[model samples]
Target: MGDVSITVLDGDTLRSLHVSLREDTVSLTGAQVLDLAESEASRSLLGLSLPQHLKSSALRRMNIDGVDDDVDFRRKELSPEEASRKLNEYLSAIADELKDNPLVASNLDGSALRMLLEDEDDFAMIAENLFTDLDTEDKGMISKREIRNAVVNMGVEMGVPPLEEFPLINDILKKHGAEEEGELGQSQFAELLQPILQEVADALAKNHFAVIHNIKIVNGSELKKVLANEKKLNDVIAKIKQEKDNGKSGHKSTEIIKDFLEKNGKELGLPPSEANEAVILLYDAVFADIDSGKGASEEEDEFRKLVTEILEKFAEQLEANPIYCDLDG
Candidate 1:
């Protein structure tokens, strides 16, 4: 694909928008075209609050099977008919990705934070609350350095980037004389903090940052894959059976299976057993509803059936109510 200018319809407004890929070179490679497409998509959808992973997933889902990245498009330029077909296929693939992943977006233009700042009563209440939280010693004043903590507490929801992400926060603190070793009363703290927050708000308004939440969606997709693979399913069952045999003899088969799942559920499309109260409740509810009287003394076929039944229950439950867990956790 050479430096081509194409017009694509805006999905939201149904308006035709021009997307031009202009490069210094006469022609682009397969990889270059893909890259341009991704860049254009991101630029056009900048206002959409999409997580980074979803954007990358959309690109990966694009159809580019036979288009070799190393091939020179200038020498093997596609005919107009072929190019049109490929373009339509790529567009369809992109649309499919968006359709599969429902979009829930929130525009972070610092307008909310600005409104709070403009409200004297709200701003004073917020400042007072922050002071009370930071002043753990019940002192009348807090160190100037505590402003950093205040900003951190404001966080992404309040239009403040993490200190580690935007090092400009440190510069803002320094400029506001927050680094100096001095204690400020609640009123003074608010006065000094106002300018710092104002600067942050201004910076965000000029150049917004996209926040990638550390959350993963689990919807039994991986469980379905494991169930589909005979080898993997056999391996899991064998492992569980071995563990059951090795475990204390008096334990119910359900308990043994629950233990195995708690320890090794990630591969089967389940979240960490102790990730949060909701996951813990999910585990409790599932196990509680199943037969707890099943013991190791059951026949081998019966044991396999029990395991399959348990997994199917999990799959059904997850499909209905997908669990969201911290990706890092």
Candidate 2:
């Protein structure tokens, strides 16, 4: 097996995966990967027994020498069945080695997880395990709803998650999943997560958005596209900022940009659902500023406030709303 980072685009689709092993990285997507999140199958063909967490395409990373395939994986395509078989061989081998470690299975219950979640590292490990473990049928991606469901079930099974929290998490994840009509692919996901992650990141920054003038508005795939090998997106954002006068006086002007994105994003052949998601992404990112208590920077505050007001248009329309970002912030 090789070291790999699998990105679950949106909530259900497997957007991209880059594997790293011995300094060699091979990224794959679509049908290129096989058994990305397998539960159980063949085993006995791996060096490191992959725990359940590692089974997820998002977490499987191993060192395989003489396997530098980054360019090839992206430019080349593989037969679905062939890719599946080769990938399965690796997964089975890893699973067999870790068979005894049920803790390595989907229902991750181990002494280490219990102790670790309690520590200050903040159980960031839990987030890892949450996203990586339990692939259902070993597909490259796991549904956001499934992950939360696993937690609620496991919490009850292990006595960790409160009964009250179980329903709440279930409701939230379910609501999010339902809002998306079940699954989210890369673009849809970028619409939701970029803002949420940026907001979360901002919260970690001195507790608010005002503390930082320049913040990452997008993350995951959207970030990859706009910022990859270029800084065009930053130019777009900066151009908008320069024209603004800082507070309510200049706030109305941003609406034009928003109108442009909303209209051009639609007229130029992008999906309206995706545009809706983009709007929400802005909301979530600004929610970080709102929640920070310090508010946005002098120049950015009004723009953010306009964004805050725009969030109201989304209302209970879950797919268009920031979902967790609204309440969380």
Candidate 3:
């Protein structure tokens, strides 16, 4: 939502600073400046909120000039101007490190999950959904171990982190005998799930988790760039023509174009064809409106027009309904 703020220990008291290299005035020591930079960089680049361990880990990896190790930086002092300059350098390095390995991160304070637990009807619906999803055999029962899967399925959107990221979840499962081999009816499952969820909520209330998502957002800006550049547009047209010539005989020009776009759309600011149902529908709708009877006999200029029109249509559609795609997948 909003830019995250960092809390720094200012002498005897802790003070919150909305650290911005462009706007904020720096009054902290070199150590405190590093702390602020690490926290701000983690939040900005990684989408982490209150990332206690992640901040420390990121700081260790950062190569700040004149700072060798933890103890050396801890004792170093800096004037306000020097602090700001160093903070910028440290954040720039962090940006470089994370440029290729982009992540979508969110802060989970457990409020939403706790609220769901508090509401009887909502919790009942959630438990029912989980039970149905877990009971793949349609037996109306699932193993207690599946509870772990249920929590994971709830995921960051529901304020539950992946078990691997938050080891405490495994401990909670063990404490509740959820790790034991046993099947549970829906009611029994809910009965056990409530306490485990309560404990998770309590733990999260104390210390939140910074959930990172391996997702990339496509919103048509890159398509706009491609459309604006004559050279890139010509290159795309040339590629499409090549694809048309090499494609299977008897396939319509529109079909060849659609296939090429689906395979190579990411660079053009389009989501993958299989990104989701919405993207599939978008491709279907765009292609359906075209003249499927148009063949390779069309002139190069006409084909270019068709390709440009198709790309424009896709750009317009994406601008209206931006898609989120799994970068890892």
**Which order, best to worst by lDDT?**
3, 1, 2
The best candidate by TM-score is: 1
**What is the lDDT for 196 in model 3?**
93
Cα lDDT tens digits for candidate 2, 195-236? 332332232232211110111112222222333323554454
Q: Estimate every model's Cα lDDT from 0 to 1.
A: 0.67, 0.36, 0.72
Comparison by lDDT, 1 against 2, better one: 1
| Candidate 3 weakest ten by summed lDDT | 6-15
Estimated TM-score for each candidate = 0.67, 0.21, 0.60
Task: Report the poorest 10 consecutive residues by lDDT, candidate 2.
Answer: 208-217
Clashes of each: 0, 15, 0
lDDT for 59 (candidate 1): 46
Candidate 2 lDDT (Cα, 0 to 1): 0.36
Q: Best candidate, lDDT-wise? A: 3
